[model samples]
Target chain A: MSRITECFNNLKSQGRKALIPYVTAGDPDPKITLPLMHALVESGADIIELGIPFSDPMADGPVIQLACERALLHGTRLVDVLDMVAEFRKTNQTTPVVLMGYLNPIEIMGYSAFADKAKAVGLDGVLTVDLPPEEAGEFNRLMKASDIDVIYLLAPTTEEARVQKICAAGSGYVYYVSVKGVTGSASLNVAEVAEKLKMIRKYTEMPVGVGFGIRDDASARAVSEVADGVIVGSVLVNKIAELTGNQEQIPEAVAAITASMRQAMDK
Target chain B: MPTKEDLAIAKQMPDAGGHFGQFGGRYVSETLMAALQQLEQTYEKLWRDPQFQAEFDYDLAHYVGRPSPLYHAERLSRELGGAQIYLKREDLNHTGAHKVNNTIGQALLAKFTGKPRVSAETGAGQHGVATATVAARLGLECTVYMGEDDIRRQALNVYRMKLLGAEVVSVTSGTRTLKDAMNEAMRDWVTNVDNTFYIIGTAAGPHPYPKLVRDFQSIIGREARQQCLAQTGKLPDALVACVGGGSNAIGLFHPFIEDADVRMIGVEAGGYGIETGQHAAPLSSHCKPGVLHGNRTCLMSDEGGQVIGTHSVSAGLDYPGVGPEHSYLQEIGRAEYTAINDDEALHAFRHLTLTEGIMPALESSHAVAEAMKMAPTMDKDQIILVNLSGRGDKDIHTVAGIDGINF
Candidate 1:
């Protein structure tokens, strides 16, 4: 089984929801990423989603978009992101690390090359924001061949027919975008998300992790109740942006939010 | 006689899945897939409906003042001293451009679908004014996303959109140009997919958009085809149009796709020059294929497939990618693409105004410049039909700024 599946299984056995925190690799600077990854694991993160920054992040809101801008300023490339993941793997092995971003960088590196490099780095899974299942057949096959989970996103606007299609295409877990807007755009209603998750459950047995608009501990805990995992992004990236000048405090500052959310979910 | 393959190439494009021979497909986020699918279904049903066709045609005739004249520019033709030049006066449309044709069609789609709001992205402000005009006509709320740089260059059109009661959003993201504006528009559509209908101004973007916008804008070709036959007793030797996102070019080329003898030429913006790498001539420069703004096409991207900034004297043409259909056509050798630098396009802008007393838009000026170059090398008996896609009024400020004039 993939590390992602194993991680989810272990969490299920422990009766605890997965706390996933996403941070852009090479944000503020490249050197801050390793410490941040270690900090996230220490803060009780079950899965760590590392972002590969692209020039244009169309689906992201201002927070994550600025994070991309910061990462790109440090001249972060797709290869650099993989190196960060490999470095993270050197010290930690249990915490599943997923690379999430847009598709252009992977396309530039060629799908086969990207899949091979990702496998070599021991990356757990991938979640390309703009790559829908309709265009992900070959990409998914390539990742699956390398024993990497190809994660997909389900949105509130997704119909039931597509929900089944996406679930079948995806592995590891399904990322359910809790709102209709881009990342960090609007607040999500837990009741609405619960209803959507129920609809998603009818199609597949895969764990559904709810993301988008999960900012504070309250939203994270609320989502954790309905979802198998609470995926938080913008708020964590915002922390990095806040500590741009004082790069030393970024890891601790961001981990504090994750720790609080983890504590809230455990309660 | 055209071969079966040639005819097939023209008719069977952008297959049901929206792939224009591996060039165009929906590469948007999962949040937008269902909305795109819904849009595709609605567009397919309405496109074949006779009532919808009649209503669209009626609006084209009455509101937009269709059948824009195909005038033989005898003076300019004589000046060029080779092929007789004809101008398809799309500049004479209600909004002073070819963009209104597609906007009117999309606006009706929004009305039929009961969408209360319409969102659009514009580069040159021609599409913004056109979209705002249609939205005002239908009492729908309209929002147009434009790059901050474009707002500065085309202030008059921005004011025109505001006068039409449309909210103009200044996009200040990466490279703040047409590409960024499109990204912002896509973001808006993803957020408000339920009640909002995004009226894409060009024959670019993902699936139904390119096909539907092409269908709507093809009126230009249909009219010009009949007009040329009626006036000259034969089809023109060449058809030229400026390709920003390729809406105007596709609009004028779709009807003539099967005319194997008629040369279709698309002019891309060569900002400084192609050799300088400061241009937006992706097809002309032979850039690699990459996905952008929901479609795969030739793009001005770095080695990492990150889209780089594109430069052009014409705001409409300052885009990183061309329409996927254009890419497909280029690959199959059905059409050819070339570039015209800023100075050359400006020369054409002045030359045409002096010779014919008609001011062409800077985007259209690229086509005018290419047509001038081609016209001089062809026989006088041959005809070159250039799509005068828009009027030059909006570009006066840009041109004046270039001339070191403030006003």
Candidate 2:
């Protein structure tokens, strides 16, 4: 089984929800991402989502958009991000790392070469924000060959027919974007998200991880009630934004919020 | 030059799934899939419906002004001393540009689909003005998302939008340009899926949009074809139009796709020049097949796939990506794409103003520049038709500022 699937299955057997904390790979500073990844695991994060910064992040709101700008300011490319992941794998192998970003970078690298490179770097999964299942053929083929999970997103407006198609294309787990709007833009309607997940569960046995707008500890716990994994992005990335120049405070500041959400999810 | 068969394969494309030979597809956030699918269905159904066609046709005729005259630029042609040049005066439209064509159709679609509000993104503000105009006519609430940079650049148009009762939103996002404005517009549409309809300004974006915008704007090419036959007693040897997101160019080229004898050229804003690495000509230079702003098209992005900033003298041509259909056309050899730098476009702008007494928008000036280049090389018997996509009134300030003139 893939690393992401194995991690999820292990967490399932333990009767525990998965905590996924997302941080842009080179945000604030290039050196802080590795420390943030380690600190996420230290704070009870089962999986780490590393953002590959792009110049234009359409699916994201202002906070994550700013995070992308901060990362791009460091001139960190896809290769540098993979190197960071490889560095993280030297110390920790149990926590699955998902590279999340837009598809342009991978397209530039060519799908086959990117999949191979990502595998060599020990990336567990990929979640391209813009690549839906309809256009993810070569991306999925290459990723499947490399034993990397091809994660898909399920949104509030994804109907039954498309849900089945998306779920069928996806492996590892499905990321359910709880808001209809972009990341960091809206409030999560947990009851509505729960209802959608109930229907999404009909399409696939893969675990559903809820993300987008899960800002606070209470919101994380609320989402964890229905989701197998709670993925928080803008909130943690904002911590790095707040303490950008202070490298010492950046990881701990991000981890403190993540740890609190983890504690809330556990309850 | 592509044969009829080679061109036919590309011309008939965006098959049911909106795939233009592995180029175009629905690559938006998953939440928009069902809504987009619904829009596709509604558009497809209304495309053939006689009433819908009548409504669209009526607007094209009366509301937006149809059959914008094809003028023979005799003085300019004589000056160039080569091919006889003709200008399809889309500049003479009601909103002083070809943008109203797509906006009217989309506003009608919004009316048909029961959307209460219409939102659009604009870089040049022409599309925003067109949308606001149509929304006022149709009594639909209108909002236009323009990049903060664009709002500063085109302050007059921003005020015009406000005067037309549109809530002009300044999108303070990445690069603060057309691409970011579009990103913000898409986000807004996603947020208000039930009541809002996003009228994409150009022939880029996701499925059905490129197709729909092409269908609506094809009136330019359709009329130009008849005008060429009527006035010149034969078809033009070549057609040229400026491409930003490629709507105006595609509009003038679509009807001629099957005409093997008529060469098509798309002019992209070279900004400074391609060699300087500071232009918006994706098809002409720095092009790769990547998904951006809803469709997989020729995008100007870095090695890491991040979309890079595109520079253009014209706000209308300042986009990092072109339409999928244009990419298909360029790839299949049905059409040729080349860049005209800021200096050449400005030269053409002044040449047309002096010789023909017609001032062209900077975006349209690129086409004029290319046409002038090719016209000088062709026989007088050969005709070159250029789609004068917009008027220059809005750009006079820009031109004046560049010339260091106060007024």
Candidate 3:
């Protein structure tokens, strides 16, 4: 089994929802990323979603788009992101890490080569924001061949038929964007998310993680009740943006948000 | 890996799944897949419906003033002293450009699909004006997203859109250009997909957009073809048009794709020059293939696959990616792509204005510049047809600024 599946299965046995915290690799600075990954793991994060920054992140709102700008300012390439994952694996190997970003980078670096490098670096999963199942046949085949889980996102607007199609194509877990807007948009309605999750569960057995509007511990706790995982972005990236000049405090400052969410989720 | 046999049937492109030989597909977030599927289905059904076709044709005739004149530039051709030159006067359209052809169709699609609101993205503001004009005629709420930079550069057109009742939202992210404006428009569509219809201005973006836009804009080539045959007794030896997101080029080239003897030429903006690495000529510069704005296409990107900044005096031609069908056409050797520097385009702008008493848009001047170069090399009996996709009335301020004259 993939590391993502194993981690989720372990979390299920303990009756706990998974906590996934996303951070753009090389944001603020590249040196802070490895320490930040370890900090997120230390703060009760079950999985880390490392963002591979692209020039135009259309699916994202302003907060994460700024994060990408900060990351790209330092010239963070996909190869550098893989190296960071490889470095993190040297000390902490149990926590699953998923590389999340757009598809152009992987397209430039050939899908087969990226899959090989991702597997070699101990990466657990991939979630390309814009690559839906309709265009992910070759990408999925390559990742599956390399033993990497390919996660897919389901929006609130996604109908039942496509939900089944995406679920069958995806492995490890399903990411449900809890709102119709881009990441870092307005507040999400837990009841609406619950309705969508209920429909999604009828399609696949994969652990369903809800994201895109979970801003705080209260929202995280609410989502944890209906989802198998609570995925938070933007809010944490906002924290990093706040401490951009004082880069040393970023790891702890960003981790504290996840720590509080983890505490709320566990309770 | 399409065989030569496959290339022969390239006119029947964008297969059922929207792949144009691994170039065009719906590479968008899952949130948009269903909407695109619905759009594809609706377009396929309505495209064949006689009522829909009749309404579209009626608008083209009465509203947009279709069959825009094909004028022989006798003075300019005599000066070039090599080939006869003809201009397909898309500049004479109701809104002073070819952009309205696709916007009119999409706005009608909006009316047919029961969508009450329409959104669009623009660079040069021609598409914004065209879309806003259609929405006003149809009584639909309209919003246009434009980059902050373009809003400042093309302020006149921005005001024109507002005069037509569009709410122009200024995008201030990611280099603040057309691609960023497109990103914001896509986000708006994703957020409001239920009651809103996105009127894509170019022959780019995801699956149904390129195909539908091409189908609507093909009226350019259809009319030009019949006009050439009726007036000159033969098809023009070549068709030339400027390509940014490639709507106008595809419009003038689609109907002529199967004309084996007629060559198709697309001109990309060479800002300073291609070797200066400051231009937007992706195909001419032999850029790599990557995905951007929802489709796989030839892109001006860095080694890391990040889209790089592009420079052009004409806002309409300053984009980092071209339409995917252009890529497929270039791949199969069915069409040739070239570049026109900013200076050459400006020269052509002045030359056409003086000789033919017609001022072409800066974007269309790129095509005019290439035709000037080609016309001088061909025999006098041979003919070149240029799609003058827009008028230069909107570009008066830009030209004045370049000439150091206060408008």
Question: Which segments of candidate 1 are over 4 A away from where they belong?
Answer: B1-3
Give me the displacement of residue A61 in model 2, in angstroms: 0.4
lDDT of 1 by residue, B206-262 (tens): 888999999999999999999999999999999999998999999999999988899
lDDT of each: 0.93, 0.90, 0.94
The stretch of ten residues in a row with the least summed lDDT in candidate 3 chain A is: A154-163
Report lDDT (Cα) of residue A100, candidate 3: 95
- Residue pairs with backbone atoms closer than 3 Å in model 3 (clashes): none
- Worst lDDT 10-window in candidate 1 chain B: B1-10
Best by lDDT: 3
Clashing pairs in 1: none
Residues B180-233, candidate 2: write the lDDT tens digits. 899989888888887999999999898989999999999999999999999979
- Steric clash pairs (candidate 2): none
Q: For model 1, how does the per-residue alpha-carbon lDDT over A107-209 read when each residue is reduced to its tens digit?
A: 8888999999999999989999888888888898999999889999999988898899989999999999999999999999999999999999999999999
Worst 10 residues of 2 chain B by lDDT: B1-10
Ranked by lDDT, the better of candidates 1 and 3 is 3
Of the pair 1 and 2, which is ahead by lDDT? 1
